[model samples]
Target: MTGISGGGVMTERKKKYGGLRSGQTIAICLAGLATLWISSGAVTQTPDKGAEESRAARGDQKILVRVRESVSQVRQSYVTVFGRTEAVKKVNIAAETEGQVIARNIMKGAWIKKGQAILQIAMNDRGAHLSDAEAKFEYQRLAYASATKLSKKQFQSRIRVAEVLSNFESAKSELAEIRLDIHRTTVRAPINGYIETFPVGVGDYLQTGEIVATVVNLNPIRVVAHVSEREVTKLRVGDKARILLAEGVKREGEIKYVARIGEQETRTFRVEVWFSNSKKVIPEGLTAELKLKTARKHAHKVSPAVLTLNDEGIIGVKAVNKDKSVIFYPVQIMEDTNEGVWLIGLPPRLTIITVGQEFVQVGQTVRTSRDEVELKGNSTDFNSVKSAS
Candidate 1:
């Protein structure tokens, strides 16, 4: 009975140990499964983190900017210059003979034609002198005729006939002098123009070669401008130009003269444009602006805000290529208007960066948001672009 009890106790202890070993195996498996679930959760979050990192890298690569798709239009290029109006011709009328002024025919500012009498000088003894000279001329003519008849008949000596002929010529010269003196008493206009100044009036004594009046012709007025050497070569004598005068008055004129040589001091060529002033309303020395069309070209109109400078300090605009790479194109300002600045020397079609151009660099890849460019009568208006998401 002692042997049986010892064996039972040992068997019972072995069973208990076996049960403990099974429980330990189960706990180890459960711990392993929990570890696998945690690893799977980490693996699941890895893809999200990688996606976030990828998006952040992409956002850093491209810079957002506003752009405008530009289509160049045909435009006329012009060279503008400041100038002033000038009279075509001016004359200073002088007295031809010494006399006392008796009557003034025209007013100080009257328009007079050629040969119109301006002032009348007193005759004085000119009429009496003319009559005396005429009588003497007739007497000498009769004596010369008698002597010539006698000389032809060989009855008078050659010396006497020569003397008589000399007397007749002398008297004829005297009569002509008297007639000329009488005629010179009236001062006439030398050209068809308006009298700008009349220094002398009625009862004013005048000497020969004294200034009596100043006449200026304004039928075809002229605008005189100085142009640079680069612009002078494109101008022709028949080219048309527009002139802006005081009070916003604009007139069309034809190029009349362009200097072949430049001025020594300023190195500028002189240009003249002629236009009609039929009413004589346009005065001389008035300020003017000349707009001379040089040529027709393709141009794009953009706001001044779109202009930028390159690394080399060149004035240009930033554009995007087909591949969305930033590009710099040098541009020349064709004109500046109230609406926008017209730019030339650009591609016929372009995608120009409007905003955030300064933040970008040449040859850099960019993301662009498009803005609308509205056109209204040669003016460009840019609409705001929305922020990129």
Candidate 2:
């Protein structure tokens, strides 16, 4: 019985020893798993740190771009407006006396001179009336002379002589009225111009103040334009202007008149520019464009491709500062030419980004390559630009 009891106690001791070994094995496996997890995290973090360092290095590098140095110069500005040609003088000739249009001398579209006869009226009883008036005037003159002689010799009373003088005056007035009526029978052109319309035929009877013909004086033709209120202030009488006609003809003119009042519907002012058309090449009612030169200003000329818009939709161009950092300059376009556009509101001396402007942003440091020949002729004349009409 004692040997069996000792064997049972030995078995119990072995079970406890086996249980402690199993617990130690589990702890060792858990320790190995924690070490592997920590090593994997370090491997992932090393790559991420390298990537962040690489991005920082790239950020410090400067973007390369091409630049051109531009200098501002005086440039003449102009205000362009569209309008039409008109005659300097237009007249509707009217008859001054009632008469029959017995003879037609001028035809429509014929150029006539001042005081040229346009129509002739019949003399209907006018000759007879003049002869009768002359005889009565002659008789009255003789009677008045005889009466004055008698009064001077004190052979006639003063009241009787005055009554005889009144009769003579009445006869003279009647004779003068008949002569004046005969002179107005012929209708004449008041000015030199082309006859635009002749409504009456040879037999047509015309009353006083009736239209005889329509005449238009085309020489020294005028260009009429309605200028905006904003632009009207820049114009004045006698200012020089350039005109472009619809048929590609160009002309020079002088501003003849400018209205002090504004048109109600369009809010514009009327302007008239006179151009010499001695050859009568410019006809009335031809569409034209007027370019009125204004004050000269300091401006820069650059290609339109360099123009860009900002976040707020402001038109500007990208340039480089003294520190080689990118900047934005707001610009106003003064004129557009075939070569480029003139820009105002920029610095007198400027460095513009000619290339790679889209890749860089404002306030970014950049590397620039100077284009020595980009800006040629700093003193370019404003007239060199082609007319953009």
Candidate 3:
């Protein structure tokens, strides 16, 4: 019995030892799996090297835009205003005395010289009156002589002789007045001009101060134009100007007068310009354009593309400063040419942006380059620019 019990005890100890060995083996396997997993993760992971290389390549391949600087001539022209053509001298021919129109030889559109008889009045009665006046004057002279002899010889009373002389003189004066009234029946033109209208015909009984015709002198024409009060200071008498007629005909003229007072309603001063119409091409009542030469100024010529608007809606060009900062300058357009526009209120030399101007904003720093090379040392060449029609 003791031997069997000892053998059982040995068997139990063997089973316990085998169970301990199996637990050790399981722990070792778990530790090995954990190490293998960590190593595999480290080998597969990367530091996004491809993305970094792509960013570096992009930075190095960035493009740099080039530009140039150039000088150009810019012309300054004043503002133009519309005006109407007027004659320097205009007159309405009218008769001074009332009479019958016995003859109407002159026709409309006839150029008549000064003192030319345009219409004749019937003077038959007038001539008769003059003849009667002469006869009365002779009779008065004979009567007065007789009165004087009678008074001198003491043959007649002094009062009676005086009364007779007075009666003869009165009759002669009445006849003379009748003759003078008859002589003022003819209608004549006062100046040399073309007849615009003829309102009388033969046998037409006209009253005194009645219009016979309308005449106009067109040798030196006058143009009446209104200028703004703001621009009045720039205008002066004798300033040179150009008048553009309705048919695009150009004529040289000078400022004749500038009104001191302004029109109440328009607040604009009236200006008169005189132009010679030797060809008579500019007719009355035709519209004309007046360009008064105000001043001459030096300005910069820039492309129209570079012009932009600011937040306040002011039109200007973008320029770059020495520190590469952007600056927007408001400019007045002095003139516009075919190639571009002439701008005022800029430095004589400027760094204007030709490209990327629209993308950039005022006060922003940007890389800049000269747009064009200077053709001359100091002088500007504007021959390439065409005149704006």
Maximum-TM-score candidate? 2
Tell me the tens digit of each residue's lDDT in model 1 across 1-389.
Answer: 99999999999999999999999999999999989988888445335788677566645556767899999999998999999999998999888888899999999888899999999999988888999999999999999999999999999999999999999999999999999888888888988999899999888889999999999999799999999998898888898999999999989999999999999999999999999999999999999999997889899999999999987899999999999999999999999989999999999999999977877778988777777643232111111111213
For 97-166, candidate 2 gives per-residue lDDT tens digits of 8878899997899999999999997889999999999999899899889989999999988998888889
Clashes of each: 0, 0, 6
Question: Which candidate tops lDDT?
Answer: 1
Worst 10 residues of 1 by lDDT: 378-387
- In candidate 2, which residue pairs get closer than 3 Å at backbone N, Cα or C atoms, i.e. clash? none
Q: Give candidate 2's TM-score.
A: 0.76
- lDDT, candidate 2, equals 0.87
**Can you tell me which runs of candidate 3 are displaced by over 4 Å?**
1-77, 138-183, 295-298, 337-340, 364-369, 373-389
By TM-score rank, best first, the candidates go 2, 1, 3
Where is model 2 more than 4 Å wrong at Cα? 1-61, 373-389
1-389 per-residue lDDT for model 3 (tens digits): 99999999999999999899999999999999989989888546567999888556544432222233535455656868889999887899878777789998689999888888888877756777788788878888888889889888998888888887887888789786876677567677888898989988998988888888988889899889999998888998998888988767888899999999999999999999998998776788989999887777778877787788989999988877777777888988887779778888877776777765655567766655455543241111111111110
Evaluate residue 100 in candidate 2 and report its C-alpha lDDT on the 0 to 100 scale.
88
